[model samples]
Target chain A: MTAAPTIFLPEVPDGDDVGLAPSISRFELERFICGELPPERRAVIDRALAADPALKALHDDVVAADRAFLIEQPPLPFFQRPAKAPSWWAGLLSHWHAGLGAAAAAAAVVVVVVVATPDESNRTKGGVEGPRVSFFVKEESAARLGHAGEELKAGDQIQLAVKDVDKKALVVVGVDGAGSVTVYASESVQGGLSKGAGSPRVLPASLVLDETTGPERFFVVYGDDVDTLLQAVDSAARHLGDDVKAGRADLARTDQLPLGAAFPQSSVHIVKIR
Target chain B: MSISQMKDQELLTGLYRTHGGRVYARCFYLLRNKEEAQDALHEVFIKVHKNLAGFRNEASPLTWMTRIATNHCLNVLRAKRAPWHEKYKQEVDVGVAASVAGGGGAGFSLLENRELLRLCLAKVATTDGSLAELATYAFVDDMKQADICVLVGMSAPTLRKRLREFITICRAEIEAHVPGVVFAPAPI
Candidate 1:
């Protein structure tokens, strides 16, 4: 398995660790609702809650909400793709900042992390002019999206694309807002302990536009930190750059999951051709 | 072929006959509406036909169709912001609530606990990260963390971390809004 980009996570501060990390994504509470999670796992969670009264209170809320989601839902006319899905085609991407102008864009755009050590030798200082990278982030279950979309700020919409994200093994893009984009998927990017290396993840990026750089539009990538997220995105984009278009061809492989070597349908990727 | 010209309207009909009950049950779980579930049934079939051209010969047509059903139901939830639905309260086994509230699942009277908390959840789900709202649903239903991980694409460890954060927010939010519950200090 290929190694993951080394990221130093912060140590759990004293008084914060209750035998487990407290920080969690909304995704975990949702798995229980869909019947997707197993039983023993729930036991562990329950026992864990016995230690945290706060967790128990929150657990009660989750239980109520899950039941609510299972109730009759209102009419949703918008979730379906517009008759024709939007074109998520390939393109040259670059980073920009607030001070950047149209004139600066003509120079090769490189959405570098002002926070990154700026070791120009390893990464492209010039985004379009530099060598290619691969990156893609996927939000898997979205069990809570229906209710969550309400909180999405207008600027929160993070737009990312490559000719073919699936083609490459790794790719990276940059963000300006620093915390606007979040790479979401059902599994962790570094879930290497369980799955094999090279598992796909939707990585995030951000930027600080300036006189020499920055594109016309601005973006803010959030969730994971910007510099680290950008590094991972660069990796995935680079990896998949080869087969973004060809990647769709393998939508043929979803059947492999259930049928030993051949699973049945591959629905998510089919609709995500870029 | 046009929608009108397809012949396995017979097979479609037959599949519906044999599996419609089960499939509708799945749709109801997400949609929570009988009519909407019925309407979604039509759309699911249209989707089945549209994608049938690319259907690989791997899984049985039934398995493939069921997957399409599940995906479509999720889509329906997404398209509609999971609007509130009319609920039939008697069916769900109220769990500990039965012991505490002396009523069936709906009858459980933690009104003291549930009333203010439910409102806080509504506020956060509608405002903060909707992930919290989704988390509330799964946790209450007692879903495993792994299932939530698979469905939402978040790491399990990371998810565990998030559930804790959201709970803190919920408790504080409830205490501030509700009259009796003692709220924990918000995590910085």
Candidate 2:
């Protein structure tokens, strides 16, 4: 009636040629799986995997082992994940890094942490406040001029400029991450994409030009037209149920509204540096 | 999907739909017991939904969740050692032994082979130098490499070296303990 002795052991395989264990890391393996590694490395590994059955078997085991570990592990909490962008991700913005694992996928959630952790002012993701726009013009005083633009009511006349027109420009306005409103514009607006019908089409007015705009020198008309454009922008932008609270719709100004440059007047461009 | 195409709400919905189950399943694997996994999964999802706004293209969501799940399961495991895992281990062994002993009955059919395979695996699992607890956590639960890497911080090279040694230990222990059960020793 003695209690059975505990534990069972298996027979060791007959060969001693298992070789030194692989040196690749779980991260590198992930990069490999993600196709993040260079083509050469992938080619080499693919060849290796195809050539040796044992190696291929080990590779499958390795992948399976990873999968099993993932299955057993709880989905890690994404809320309080890392803040700074991983170097690899920040480096390659074009590539959509996806399905890597809970760790790599968790990158989406950590993004929240990173964005919030900044803005020393502890800005909450509160409801939309009114648009607070700032026009980073080529001049210094113009920077502060935007404060006035926010207070501009309808019928107020102001002059602004026409920035580069891309097929579909990525504009940044009121908000940073959430403010890219691609507006299709008229043919007259430099590189305007879509326009016609004997007259020009109204651009999605609030469009913010990219850095390559070079602070292009031109003028814009602000009055009933500007107000109408702004309203249209606000409406179209929030159409997707965003209720976008524009910070400030900055309209770049140069001088009195243009009264047709060809009116027997001048080609002389003058900034009243008063 | 294009960023412009999916509205925020749609994106949020997609996040839940795609990742919810696997995440929960993983929790179950970590806990190895049912309720604990469920609880952990609930907590993570709630946190994710609440904090979706702050995402700023930082660390990927996968990394984020692994850290959370890793911390959560580890917390649960550390909190109560013998409760969940021990009970599970006992039940599994008993179930296997009974089925094998049962007169080649219904439950003994498919599970029979699976049980044998699992028992063999368990035996193999023991040979690693890891304590029964550490070994319990290192299961192959169908995670991607990144996820597994997060769970086990030690690099692949390190794991390879240690796993071989650990497997050897388990094999020796099994051979010494189980009188005549001849089985192939897993790689050490």
In order, the candidates keep a fraction of the true contacts of 0.00, 0.04
Segments of candidate 1 deviating more than 4 angstroms: A1-274, B1-33, B52-137, B140-143, B165-178, B182-188
Estimate the lDDT of model 2.
Answer: 0.34
Best by lDDT: 2
| Per-residue error (Å), model 2, residue A106 | 29
Give all candidates' CA lDDT scores. Answer: 0.33, 0.34
lDDT of 2 at B68: 65
What is the number of residue pairs that collide in model 2?
58
Please write out the lDDT profile of model 2 over residues A81-154, one tens digit for every residue. 01231211121111111212322223333323323332111111111221111221212122111222232222
Where is model 2 chain A poorest over a 10-residue stretch in terms of lDDT? A262-271
> lDDT tens string, model 1, B14-108?
34434444455545555566667666665666665566556534234433454566566655554544343112112221322233244222222
TM-score of 1: 0.27
Q: Write the per-residue lDDT of candidate 1 for residues A1-274, one digit (tens) a residue.
A: 2221111112223232222224332333333323334678666565657787766676576566434432322111111112232111111112221211221221112122211212211112123332212222212211111110122221121222221111112212221111111122111122332242222221222121122211111111111232343344434333333333344313222211111111111111212111
